[model samples]
Target chain A: MREPISIWCFSGVLLFIYGLLIFASGLWELAHPLLHPPVLHQLHAPIWWGAILTVIGLWYLIEFWPHKRASQPKE
Target chain B: MFPATNLWMVSHLAGMVAHPQSGLIAAITPSGMVRLSPVDLIIIAVYFVLVVFIGFYLKESSNTGEDFFMAGRQMTAWIAGLSFVSANLGSLELMGWAGSAYQYGILATHWYWIGAIPAMLFLGIVMMPFYYISKVNSVPGYLQLRYGPATRALSGITFAVMTILMSGINMYAMALVMKVVLGWDLNFSIWVSAITVAAYVALGGLRSAIYNEVLQFLLIWAGSLLVPILGLIEVGGWRNLEKQIIHNVGQTGYLHMWTTLGHFNTNPMGVNWFGIVFGLGFVVSFGYWTTDFLVVQRVLSADNLRSARMAPILGAAFKMMVPFIVILPGLLALSVLPFKLVAQDIAVQTGQHSFNEVLPLMLVRYCGPGLLGLGVTALIAGFMSGMAGNVSAFSTVWTYDLYGAFMNKKASDEHYVKMGRWCTLIGVLVSIGTAYLVQHAASIMDYVQALFSFFIAPLFGTVLLGMLWRRATAAGGFWGLLSGTLTSFGLWEWVERDPSALRYVALSPDAKAMAQDIFRALWAWVVCVIVTVVVSLLTKPRPVAELEGLVYGVSPIPEEHDDHWYQRPMVWAGVVFAVFVVLNVIFR
Candidate 1:
């Protein structure tokens, strides 16, 4: 009954991509504080948010990897 | 030559000082909304790309009519539940009710709780068994089963028209927000959102729409959670927010829910407790949560009877908490954000007491660039989820119930699937046109509520009677529906004909449009019930065999999958009821 694509798989991929972007942004902002506007220069919300996204994305990915593998052999 | 960055900053500061209030608050201008940093743009681009990817990804698997329209009946409880509530959590619900909370105070929470929970529980425990067991693909399809084709056609066409019009209203509402926040061209905003929704909906069908809705639910939560959290922190927590709001608004009633609701004069809602409990909580709320196809369609896509029934219960649990995300921002706006500045332009656009830019203003104040993009994206996600909900429901009803049933009954399933796609395209285009038409009308929230009173309230009455009463004849159903609809119109028209007439019913002169909507729904429900009962008794009832799976008493009940006592629907209902009482008592 497994479809070719499900919401969980794509949610993982997309969340991963989004997490990667936030993580990179957090690193970049932390490395070069002068480039960012003063309002955003000091806030660590991005770093924390990015870390949360990373953890969530990894969980979805780990959960989905086996399902994808199981369905691949049938295809 | 280009201006220096320093010079541009100086000019921006000067512009802020030139505003009515002298502070760092920038006047909402076109460039300010669109002038996202590189990181912000990248984030939004990623979101859109992922959304389109999800849409087309599911398209390949959806080959059959069932797959296209109903997700092949494979949705789990959480998916169905989330999509059910998310579909209802559209831009109108978020932006409109948030603004209502600002204007009407904590009493607006009534729409979230008392107005929703009881009816949602009713739908879950009592009504869904019939819907799932009867195996109707759409609500109109159910009508066709219960009352015959005449009732189906009437309900079908009314629902189809209402869905498209409501979809267009969502488009229009979103465009209004964009124009106010981003200063984007109205037509451009409408087309961008319309095209995006149409593309995904047409590509992947209901499955795609539901999947994206779940995603939007998460995004909305992620994006909006910070506003209340930060707002609470900035205001020194909930107690401080209450005190500051009272000081700023000069009213203690804004902090309490039921205390001021004793009379219209005492409440900011301008609605007495009787009107709040009966008009909204009973009639309007039941009419909408119990019967609206846009929401019911999500639950209908569930895998089995248990999932279908549990969907709304799960939805009700989540639904009870939504006021925190949507309404809290409005409450925060009353204290943390300056009223005079944000109210300047939105007041002109919406023709309301305060600016409806509560959420957007709060976002601007609290979020910096990176988080700002995520916040705005969440708002966009909300708008798109709503549009998708409307368009997808419209396409299904148009394809299965209207086009498939009436125009060509003998078509193949594949043919119907193709037709559904075409209808999705056409539905979005029609909504775009309707969005433009709605620009000249009054506020989006008021217009939407009035339409619900006219259409959904009556429809709910007919549906409630048909499901519970097997003796109810088809002739009774048809006439009851017709009478209920006409009565709502007649009452609304009478009020419009003489503006002073509302006072005769003890309505305040400055009562919000929602009050009138409540009264109209109450009267319409009464009319529908009366006409239906009177007509039903005069006609011969359908045979018990014909009513077996469709009616409450004669229907062979399905076995409960919930082997454990805690999993029972009644237990969940009781738990939800207890929590609702606790919330009311605490907020009261």
Candidate 2:
């Protein structure tokens, strides 16, 4: 049950990508002030994308919402 | 502009409110609250007396580990609900976030409207079913059942880290406030607040803490609520105050953080919509609402699962009401006083604190003594209740999870309870000491929450996969936990750490102006969840039988649940989701 190297790699790649995104975002910031999005646009841009992911994940969860509980477990 | 004498209970309370005409807020406290005034010291005495007495009152119940840890599992729904909400509110929320509200505007609390309230409700109905089906001693134990031991241990340890990090900062903050508001020596204030809270926590464990928290919560609320009411009256009334706010904001909505005006100066944490939703809303709310140990223990300790579920949901309602009392005054402080400090967050300050100085500057400058005492008492109550909750939660983690689980396995229930007392003593001392380390953090609010957020999200990955993924292997689960944490930390230090790193992403103009980098912190959560799941999927699955008990909360009694909560998660979820759409549409 110990974790595999893949999990770590997965984590590492994410960090790298986020760092990568930040690196990319830095290019954006360096461009200087742009128009502020409308209030709703301002709030939901991150949310809509995150929600898309979350809903997809949650959809996976709903399919097995009532999955049976196992009486036996690994200690 | 005439003040409303009806709600204006405290005299001179208006002195601190910001007004364009006025040069400064808290202008009356220009001289600073003189040393431990007899009135301030008396408030301390009354607080100790009531708290200590309650400690003894609940001592009989603390004779067992169950009593110490879960208040003997007999807590009523209302109390548990209130306690859950109150405990989650550390000193920082009142002093720090409120300050943010004051600096920014009312829209900051919008996170509660969209994010927190729904999440709490989701946990209420969605989680209660699973919780009722499984009778676990803790959230991690449930993780062990659904996921595997590796996942269990990972979840347990991560939660403990979260508790320590959060509790540690909370401890630091309360002491800092005491020093500032009471004008006591820093060391003395830290020790006093820590030791005082620890004593009651040790005396009766969660029960004592919970009960004391109720009193403290009410007191704090009274104090928080009093600030703006008194201020508006003193400013000559809301008409004048609104003028100041409209003047300060101009064209932009001052009550909202919607505008991209100066980014760094406002929303310093970069708590834009995404940060609020994903960082605080989804990641923080889901992770904490569903799984945080401090919150879970309170619910589990309740008399019934129904109450347990109701506690958080009810608590959510209470939390939503908070912006009215706490944040409004902060905004009022801005309009009445005019803004000076961006990072003027109370928790960020060290050495010199005058919490009483927040409201009393008005009393000292504009009002009289009688009202000041009442307002001061309320503030103290707010501070102490929050501090007490932290001390209590810390001891539970140390005792039940660390001490009883590892150090003293065979100790009888009585001995376990006694050990909890010792843990409380040590936990308090350490926390007080840890408070000193917090100021050194980048932004006490951002640094600690982000640290926890980076590490904690992987947990969501493991738990979700473990319960839902039949193919999820013990190996995968374990690996995911480790990898998730490593990835989060690695990203935090490497990419997000560089101010220039996230400088490239094309964001709204307002996003670019932010003082702190929000992208990196957001990425940490994303990466951790991804690695945990992928690794779990790629790795081997546990034997179905072995994974059985872990996935579902199976118990001998077939955990009883009311039919009422089970039928309507969709309704709740749908309503909440629709609101999200509407908020965007209307606000758009």
Candidate 3:
């Protein structure tokens, strides 16, 4: 059987990278205060944003992986 | 992070905004550079890489003419819906509207809500079945099926030219933003954007463009979400933002949407409810949302009739949130950014600068380095997506509608696909020249909206009457369209020749170009409907048997009853309408 090409594969990878960037930016903002100030003077906002993005990314990965794997060739 | 950098930017922005005559500063000093931090660079790099990756990934999927032009009719509702809105949420929208917000205040939100929501809902519920079930490849093809070949040719050629011109304007706007915010060279910026859009669109065709649009949509949200959130917090929430705006501008009307629209003199839009309702809402908005191929092409790519119907509805839902990010930032800039000009004489000596840089200025003031990079990337993504949307639509229409219809008459699928690719490249190159021509306009957004009134308003009148009224004949469609377009041009020329002439029509004396645009659309639309009806009555109409699925009552409705009640198009449209009412009431 041909492998099913899910739109999720494309959307998932893009979201995952975006999530990781937001997470890293939050960590960087926390670590280097003078270089990158907390956006709008709230330290917690970035952290929360990071967590939300990370979860969205993980959700795409977890939900779509089985369908993707099931359609792959056994070899 | 850098207090010194912040101080420098604030002082420079103050110099620019104090004078109203100059456009953007001719050149930024070395200190004005918005350098991306390592983290920010990485984020932007990843964004570009992903865009290229998606284009290449979808290349193989577009093997045939159908796949290349229409995505092989395999798009889900969510993907098509997101792409539909993303194609619209381009640089012209983000930057142009933010500047408009700064200049016109929250009245600009009407363009997003009442100006858009109803028409989008109408498209999904009433028009999608005709478009989807008929299986016409392009909107012009539908015209051909409904009216005749002549109507299709007129509309198709005009649409092709307009789409390319729109793409060029988008490219020009994007380059202008980059030059202002990042101090990038203007020509360099234009060429880079032009090349990038042409590359991906030519390779992956409509599917690649749609996929990238979905990706860009997410980035736009993520990048722009912070502006309102942080802006509200800084300004002490929505009430405070309202307070600050009133304090800054000395007007309570700026905060309320529909309340001030009772009279032309009361609102910043400088037009009354009649113009907003009958002109923008009924004519301009409906014309753009319902008939513009830039957006309809996305819906046409849907996998099923249900998906096609749901696409615009989903887009309408997302369209509601746009003003929050794009407009609120402009309002926020009024409170935060400085407007103390260099000096009256110095402004004369040094050249005055406009506040068109409102969004970029706010970004500099609010966002830190990493987040700043992401935000800038979002702006670039928006511009490219918009250009790509225009380019892809242009190629499809040019290849299928004009080239295939008249030039070749009978060509293989492979031959047409090659022609589409060539058209895509030529379209982008021509757009680069069109970009240069856009410099004559006073404001980018106003220029774009004016183009809509001139071209699209009349087109909408003809299409709307043709779709619902089967009595509309081919001669009526052609002559009605021709007269309406000519009427719009004459109105514009008359108004330009004598500024006082509009007062005779009951428009305000001091009304800006935008208000004139509204009235112009109204006149053209009226002319179109009257002419179409009169001509159709005098001419022989096509037989009812021939109309079939192309007309409203001539054919059986597609099998959509098996779906759940909640999933019905009417149900979704009702929900959208309810939300639209609640929003207007609250804002009013």
Write the residue-wise lDDT of candidate 3 on B228-338 in tens digits: 777777788887777777888898877788888878788877888888888878888888888888899999999999899999999999998888888899888777665
Which candidate, 2 or 3, has the higher TM-score? 3
lDDT by residue for model 1 (B253-348), tens: 888889887767787767888778998888888888878888899999999888898899999999999999778988888887644434434433
On DockQ, the candidate that comes out on top is 3
Q: Please give, as one word, the docking class of candidate 3.
A: acceptable
Query: lDDT of all the models against the reference?
Result: 0.77, 0.54, 0.77
lDDT of 2 by residue, B1-588 (tens): 000110011111112221112222223233234233343344446656767767776676678777787788888777787777776654445544454465456555654465467667766765655654566667676665565555666666666555655555555554444444444455765666676677778887888878766665555553345455556665667668667777876634554444432342354334466555555566655665666666666677778766776777667667767766666666666665433433322322322222223333332332222223334555555555665665566666655555656577687888877777887787666666556665444244454554665555666666656555677666766676677667666655654566454343313434432222234334544665566667766776666666544454322223544578643334544554565556545433
Interface RMSD for model 1 amounts to 2.9
Higher-ranked by DockQ: 2 or 3? 3
Every candidate's DockQ is 0.37, 0.01, 0.44
- Candidate 2 docking band: incorrect
* Candidate 1: segments with Cα more than 4 A from true spot: A1-3, A31-43, A66-75, B1-34, B338-346, B349-354, B440-449, B505-512
Selected candidate, larger lDDT, 1 vs 3 = 3
